[model samples]
Target: MMITMKQNSRAPNAITSLDVYLNSLKVGVIVRTPGDFSAFSLNESYRQTGGHPVLSLSLRAASGGLRKDPKPVSKTVPAFFANLLPEDKLREAMEKHHAEAVRPGNDFDLLAALGADLPGAIRVVPSEGSLAVQPVREEGKGKARFSLAGVQMKLSVMKNTGKGGGLTLPLDDNDGQYIAKFPSTAFPGVSENEFANLALAEAISMEVPERELVEKSDFAGIPEDFDTMSDGKVLLIRRFDRDEGHSRIHIEDMAQVFGIYPARKYDGAAYHDIASALNVAISPSAALEFVRRLTLAVITGNGDMHLKNWSLIYRGDGNTPALSPVYDLLSTVPYIPADGMALSLGGERSFKALTADRWKAFAHRARMPEPAVLRAVTDTVALVNENWWQLPERAHVPDRVLDRIDAHIKTLTPILTSCANS
Candidate 1:
């Protein structure tokens, strides 16, 4: 069902409609109708070329036939587009700085303001008969041009500076290659804790992105207000979705792939669901990696591996997607004493309650071989026990933070020990 757009003279200059492009190919159009309702329809040309739907299963023909149609997605903001927008306080700041007066349904305005250098290969620009794409800003040096999603207050930056040393903010529409995460004002020493946890994951042979500790003094372009509160140290996480040339690689989180809203990220989803989705949408090996990461999370006291935390990356090919590198991993138990697992595993959320039998059941539900599942879990336990102790020092985590995490890890030692012996 191809719907060709006829030019409307009443279109607003603030982007009442947008043309969605995936890597230079026009995939669809997002339009805001009367009563502030919004809808996205896939272009007929994209469907004819056998291109993958931007929203996957959520935006497909209802008849289950070979002919694809442009369906009006129920979500006012598509999952793929929603995932790119900032969340919580960051979103509030963005709204205030850009278009504070825009109504709730005017997501196109927000996209037009911050869509230039977003994650993945998706680009949203104004459609014909609507406003033209916003002009590029000529801001002062050190001003950030790009925006990052999620609730955390972080900055996208380029770590490589030739003769001039220090971090460079992605100003002037520069696509950054690294994410510089600062210590949270509420959670002290979070940067060190995450660095330590990520180091431990890498030590256990997990496929993690390259990361390092960056001192504030060594970095330029840090906002003065942030510099005042920060501990002069930040975790520099390499962007797994970007190549060496800083080009965008397609990646979608579990929420996007499953068509679940970000609010329900922790609820209505389980580990088995993630595994099953990976097995169907990607490969069995990707599902196995999910299990390995889950095992690591349990041993490391990480209680925040929610749907948004896990992602699948497309490797230049249009047909296949693989599990992306592990990210947003850290021990939340130390900061929040009552924190629990974000999603259930084998119908259980408590790490201490996860037994071998439950893991086998989870494997069965995920359609994985039971024996291979057990081996992965047991081997991960052994690996963590062998390498976890040396990571805090190597990562330069503070003594107090290390002590808290160590205490929590000790509580789970019995469980790990039992699994290993079993």
Candidate 2:
């Protein structure tokens, strides 16, 4: 079934609206309505435009044109649009910082303010007024054109841009190349944990972006208040959505693909669904990549690999899609010992779900080629076995956390049972 939205038939009047553009092509208009999310309508020209990248999998029809479902988002905007804005304290911080231009707790206003530099190649500017210029909180300091999702304390900064230039705040003209993640007081050593996880993922031949941990002292141009929020060291991950020339490369997550809101990201979807969609819309290789990445999450005890965590990248071409470079790799069992997988697979969400029986069942249920799926799992497990202990990034991981990861890995290695026979 195609993903569909129901729009309210309210009398058109003086309501605020935002122009949604993907790579300079006007895709649609979202009008603020008395609903959970604003109402949206696809632009007719965009519908006629050939070679435009798929905005969201939910919006496309089987005939290769925009679905004429008529209305979009009766209670809320499309999940794809909603996912563009930040969430939790980070979103609150953005609203607080831009309170001068927009209403508090208003997502529509927040999108208008932060839309210029959101994730992916999309831009949501006010159809009526000029795009909001970031208000300088500190005298003579450039405010970062900042708008990244997630609850982490992250600052978008341009790292080593010009001759002898170090870390600096990114502007509209000069967008950030890397996301500088700071230490979380609630989740201590998160940067270290991710660093170690990335290194381990690389060992298994996963495609991850360039990443490193940097001292807070090396950071420059961070807003005065944000600098205070940081601890000693930070993790910097290069953005994959932007190219060398800093143009936009489109991206979308499973939540958008499933046509569900972000709040329900962990629910109403599963790893099986993601793999199935990738195989159908993209290629078998992309589905295989998903298998390996989820295996990375499973062995590492990463319980936070929710729908939004997995994504698809479009390299400016409209139809072709691939799994984006791996990111947000965290070892969460140290913080929450009883945690489990974010999405269910083969009727299981626990660490013990990686059984040989479950792997075969998962492939059969997802309609994927069983042999290839099993190989992806066995390859991931084998690579982790061969290279995990000696990972150089282990130096960043604490001994306690490292021990926990090792313990988790041991539990999953036994899934190599039928793997050898496969």
Candidate 3:
């Protein structure tokens, strides 16, 4: 997987610029600046197009609408692109293995290296005069070129059908139809927790991805380094951003929607902010979806519903967006013991702080009817209560996690009853 010294030396054969694309539409070009950083220029025609994906909501004009200036970025790697790349050990592993290709300090190079298949429909390919993307390297290292914008060790995988069908990190040129997340030693049984949580969500009829819990051996082209989890299982989520035929359906998490850096995912903004944004830009139904999921988090003790965990999915040629399928729904109180809400609800950051007043404040801020808000809360509690017993007793979840969820449900049950009586 090593790149030759000639390409590293920039011997007139290294990638210097990249053509950014949304699906087949030309979006823009990213070029190296005089200061050896990066800058992006939006294609005038694309900018003028009524429904073109503008890469991110952050790029929209301050006045809002289709107008985009694409402010000249001066980072070693732009923040938008930086958010698209993995963080921490995942990034280090990618850089270490693809040393000759992608690297840190300048994420533009990294994006170019792995841009063939990226999140959403965004594709970044080397413009010319360079061979940034090399042939399929030995082993599965070549498949590591795809990117997912989080600190977690995640992979985009393609699923097989018929016979002994399983998932594989495709060595050929196709985006993963499913996103595979492995179990964490730091937080054991996270996959199981998410599987159970998603089961509840599906039972409630909330929009959610098709999910499966499979063994690590289920993967066909997984790297040897990641084969440590012999008995451990992986969670496979059908990619919502891809169509039935596997074409890209563009998406941007609220973090990308707000133009905030990934480090600030937990900082700044609250649930009210999300509701307000969804009301104005997306739809009232999207905001209602937020309420349903937020209620699920409160009752399940899932305290990590940060901005990055919520997303807006763009479908068709229309610029309209909808709340994306739920993901990362594991209960955090099991691990943190005292875990609460990731963002404040009505300005409170505690699970015990979820009261009638908070729901009133949240509905007031979002400009939704209080009865509608109350209905969402009551329905969520009812759905989980009804579905809990239906989940398999041997759901692969840890006993402590189940106990925590039961406690939250008990805590919320009376509250819902109190509100109904009042």
Candidate 4:
């Protein structure tokens, strides 16, 4: 029911105390804290809709008693959609795709081998989504846990809360609720870029959820000397996941619905069979098809896409699961000197060799015909090219960053078009 930890600045690892609750609740994951006295609880309520469960939850803020109003909070996608999948069957499908992507002499399994870290830094939260983080035990260390309006914030061991630093805070800004990500050094850097890419993808006609780039100045209670400053960076982003004032439908992540879900090649059988496997509303074929198009987007160098990066939001009396608006979009290929592919595109960590041939290979593996893949590729490229420059100027992306994106677009267009048409 409860767990405790002290600040340990060592290698990236989950606080061991979380193991007890993770073993017990079967849904929650526990994390670390900067100080003491941060607490929260997650109570999920499921209702049947169209033969699928529409999950709604109340995130109660409590330390000793009933704290904030226990309003029902819902995300975009239902996790049960993945629950219907059988692991072995999905693995079989993945094997087939792996065969297609890996060349005879290559020492890598492009579509199936790369291990995808959990999506966004958020899932680093306890699986159960409830937490009772005792603040860091340093003298004069204020309660690291704080809330603004109705949203709450907490720190954790090096996990991706998208904070670009270790301190992950939840806030109610822009009249909507969101989790602000500040990643610690031990985590990945592409986390911030992915959020930018989310914005780009949404603008390019990809359906994603509504999100905003939150600034540190926009947040209160943070120390003026907080170690967030690095390499001239001064701001942070907060993701809008909950509209705290209103009750909405909730759909969870694919992994949350099933057991430990692996992030592998996007073309795996899991993509095609998750709906039926999980017995949720999404059909395997449709889910795989959606992923096919998404894969093309990634290999074309949208490398910021990851597991938690993609989600299903609820609509229509907040009961049905639909993809959230694309947010946090940016071109990492020419930006970040890390990997060239988004997290696990068609399962490959690097898309440097991704060509028209590889595109067809990926399509075949996803069970989507090559022609459909071609069309989707063409459409996405056109949309990105048409809107790339226009969007950066208006979105939260800074001007210098926009110019770099513009230059990168020119460099990327040839590859994108060739692959799409190929």
Candidate 5:
């Protein structure tokens, strides 16, 4: 089952082109050089129809123009393209299952493996005259091609047959509408932890996707390790990037927009950097939303809000995109006490050291109104203080975990209150 580089009939080493589809429409083509460098060009018809640009500001311009590159715009492959592939444990699973070794930084192989069902409306397929991109399919299903980027041990699965039913794993199918995250063996009840965290965010009136905690019995034929405990529960997060009809909607992460690799998601950047990028790539509302989410992350003890965790969803009206609904919201402090904030906030990774002055400085750097920034922080802190405890109570989080989080929240309350009062 070894997968070798596909050769085109025209030339052995001829450039390989993959048709990039936005839902059913072919919007562009990503070309791969003999040296394995990838570059994208918008389709002429899509350009004429004034379709939205696929890549973000760093690789593609607002006017539907790709960055000028004597070589490819990106040295290996575009960060946007690279960010779509599976990473860490999931990647190892993909390679083992497909029997194809994904080369380091080789986006071509990664896309060929799971290009059919990506995060957004964009789908990559081999163009005519290029080597055909074949996906490993199940017997009755067309192609079971899907990949979710991240280090987390999770799987994409279809929703329950009816309301209040259980979710089914789509291991042999590609039409999944939800992402199921298992409880980590290393951290007991992590599924419940994330569910409660997301529920808390929703209670605070934050834009978060619908989620549920389903019992392991709901799913059939899943691996034993996936259901770590005898009574383990799975957190099912509905895909927000999909439309009402379950069609793919375009979305890109902050790492892709900032032209940074996923490996460097937590390094060499700060909250202000993402806010500034949002201002330039999206609208004022989106930038403001970014500020609010950042505040929420700080107070909720979510130290894993890295670049890949924040994303922009394309509205299909043009190049303009909006901030996506919050996903992967969880308190990491309880599990890893030594863990700091994923990205520095106002040049401070320590949650305790964050002050009003630092927030104002971040606002200045992001070109946002200072008063509005302060209000967002104050509002978020107030909401968390008022309703945070209700989340654990409602979700029935373990008493031990609840006590630890409550203690952590207490320490954070005075700091946030002082910042708001200032």
Candidate 6:
């Protein structure tokens, strides 16, 4: 049975939180997104939905599609879950109360329910028009790995190093090489939108990593070359963590590098701090350039820009560092509920509070030369104002949100002009 929700009923509203469930045994983890994209676990675990989250889901995997259920079913999966009580305590609980802790839902099902018949560069569809999606199976190596699109990739359990989720892997094939990021649950779809914006960045000649999107699938449980509903659902991109010849580079989130470990303290680490930290020779004038880029992001309504969303990748050769591509990019003001930008602009915490002068001042502090700043800001305006909205023929974005963005851009013109002329 392929289940469907109301077309716009369950749409994500500025996805705010993500929860990660790490299997006690190994790197096997499951990311659970609550509230906006709320749903429950399909697996058998005492700690199911209500149990406390063991890990966090990476923001990179944007979304997945649903396939028809080829098999029979138990009752509908629960819509919510509770954290597991301490094992010692659960044993003492009265028998009748156990099931009460994990209430099942009658209507709610898998969050991703759309079936897809997406195309790829390498292969044609099998004789079967579409494929069904099954719950992830536990087999060979006891790993929770799956494939996507026509690509064969594996998901191994990750051990959390102090900095972030640690189950890092390579997304390499004959085409190009990239790193896959797996974050604990609660991450907004930062990585997913970043993949979409990378194409826009490249169009404007922004230096970035070579990457592409991959569909999700299963290996053992899924027949070889079978169609999958989850295929073409997630946005997979190349990781700048590694470069040519497969050498890993030194990379750290600004949070850890700046010593602001908690999620709430990320804003304290400014763009200038990150810019100044870079080795100058290879990334000549990168600090100033980044400031200009940041201004462009603000005016363009890429409200989701945040500390974890930004990165600096050092070439394995110890060359100068460069801003990782403009990833996790989106006009979240329209899609999300925060009603403002993720990382503040010019010290203003909210997007509605940002002004053109403040944007310029921020760029100046970043040490971007006036000319370069002007060019980056002006160039981005030209690229986006002329395109982006038209890029997607049938996207989930609302028209009103797009219109609001246009008005915001209009308001920014005078400020951008002052900088350009100065």
Superposition error at 314 for model 3 (Å): 1.5
Give the runs in model 3 whose Cα sits over 4 Å from its true position: 1-14, 51-54, 62-64, 129-131, 134-143, 160-165, 225-230
Instruction: Point out where model 4 deviates above 4 Å.
Output: 1-176, 181-199, 208-215, 223-227, 231-240, 261-300, 316-319, 342-348, 392-404, 419-422
Q: Which candidate is the best by lDDT?
A: 2
TM-score against native, each model: 0.86, 0.89, 0.89, 0.51, 0.86, 0.49
Q: What is the lDDT of candidate 5?
A: 0.71
For each candidate, the alpha-carbon lDDT, in order, equals 0.71, 0.76, 0.75, 0.38, 0.71, 0.38
TM-score of 4: 0.51
Clashing residue pairs in candidate 1 (N, C-alpha, C atoms within 3 angstroms): none
Give the alpha carbon lDDT tens digit for every residue of 1-422 in model 3: 21112242231125668777788877778887676667777788786774366467777765765544456676555566667777776667666556665545457767777776788888776665244554336653554567787777778888888998978776535678888888888877888889988888888898889998988877786765344342467888888888998788888888878877777888768898999899888878788888989988988888899988998888887377888889988788878978889888887878877887888888998798888888888888888888876687326788877787777778867775454543
lDDT winner between 2 and 6, please give it. 2
lDDT of 6 by residue, 251-338 (tens): 4344433434223333656655555454242253666556656665666667645555555544433323456565555555444535
Q: In model 6, what lDDT does residue 419 have?
A: 51
What CA root-mean-square deviation does each model show from the true structure?
4.5, 5.6, 4.2, 14.9, 4.8, 17.8
Model 2, stretches more than 4 Å misplaced? 1-15, 33-37, 69-76, 133-142, 160-164, 224-230, 416-422
* Residue runs of model 6 more than 4 Å from their true location after superposition: 1-139, 144-195, 217-232, 278-284, 367-375, 387-418
Full candidate order by TM-score, most accurate first: 2, 3, 1, 5, 4, 6
lDDT-superior candidate, 4 or 5: 5
- Compared with the true structure, what per-residue lDDT tens digits does model 1 show for residues 1-422? 22234443221235667787776667888876665556777787777766664435344444632334334454356665776777776666555444333333345556765665677766666676343322332354333435577877677788656786678666535688888887777777888888888888888878889998877776776554234464657889999878988667877788877677666788958999999888876778878878888988887789889988988777766446778889998888778777778898888888778887678778888889887777788788778878887655445766677777887777876775565544
